[model samples]
Target: MSMIQTNDFDHVNLIEKVIENNYMTYFNYDEFTNKLEFENSISSANWNIIQNNLLINITDSENIENIIDKLIDHLIKLHDEFGYGFAGVKQIIEQNIQYINQPLLNNILDWLIKNQISSKYIFFHGFLYFNGII
Candidate 1:
């Protein structure tokens, strides 16, 4: 197993650095890549590394913009790559709505509308209503 999988090594800083540098970083990627991996890129796998290794240990002192924004960017890229095959990204967005600010949420929802996915329009309407943003 790699040092990252063993959890005995100090990989937090390394992971954080990777996240700041590339929002598309994934544990499965053998190298830091600038392009999105269509076959292996799933929201759950990416989120696993971030949520388990990085966010869980974050302190209040940490500037979380890079981490959150990177994940958001990654998800958006995934949408761009796969189009309607967005169930994974949708789940991530729904669960993370509370963590993101209104502007970022607007960006995400706007992208969804631009895609013209009927279900997403219905979904975001409910999201806005339930979150008291309507």
Candidate 2:
């Protein structure tokens, strides 16, 4: 009888593979403005790339919920460390939401609400305040 073979991989390896396979675009913050600008144009290819990459990375992790929780922690840390203005915070949250699952987004929203941070402030006022950044 013939037997099928299987392969085993770790979370880090999975994340690397996911990133390599997807997320064709990369960006860095502008030194002068401290703003994140996409290096590539916004297109279907780019959107699919990013979405697939994030999905794979999160799915491969041991605990997806933990990954999202850690991401929130990092966001809080960034806010504390860099004193990210409301606009910056909003942008970060929006970007994260776009990449993460709905449940994770809901958790983030709930956390922000519990902290007395209004979603409206982050959505509307935040964009208006940082129009120049975009």
Candidate 3:
């Protein structure tokens, strides 16, 4: 029998990372753009971590439905509270769900709909949605 570990703290750490990079301290357009670029890099790195973790469970044939459900739930909460720029995060999530046959994909989409959360909330949603993760 395999057991699933609830890594709420890990999720919290991810949220903190998002919050730490999403805000502007000053109003320099160039600086703001640079900061956003940096934040995008960090977000990519975080998504890699999340993807690796999910791959591990997929290899093990462990049920990841709960894990994905919790992740989306946490993300929605973070967005609602902090409005963190979640474009990268949403991209990663959409990709993973499309590439992997996970039951929790439906849960994620459901949560997004119920919360009225859209890819538009994230800065890169326009590009991503045009590419079709709307």
lDDT of 2 by residue, 57-132 (tens): 3443335445544555545664677455454555564555466666755554454445445554354333433553
Model 3 TM-score on a 0 to 1 scale: 0.28
Candidate 1 global TM-score: 0.24
Tens-place lDDT per residue, model 3, 1-134, is 99998763565566456468965222223323223123333221212223344321322243444544444554565356534346545644565546554444454445444544554334233433465764
**Per-residue lDDT of 121 in model 1:** 51
Error of 1 at 21 (Å): 39
Candidate rank order under TM-score? 2, 3, 1
Candidates' RMSD to native: 15.6, 18.4, 17.5
* Model 2: worst 10 consecutive residues (lDDT sum): 41-50
Model 2: how far residue 42 lies from native, Å? 28
Give the C-alpha lDDT of model 3: 0.45
Clashes of each: 0, 0, 0
Give residue 45's error in model 2 in angstroms: 29
Query: Could you tell me the C-alpha RMSD of candidate 2 in Å?
Result: 18.4
lDDT of each: 0.46, 0.44, 0.45
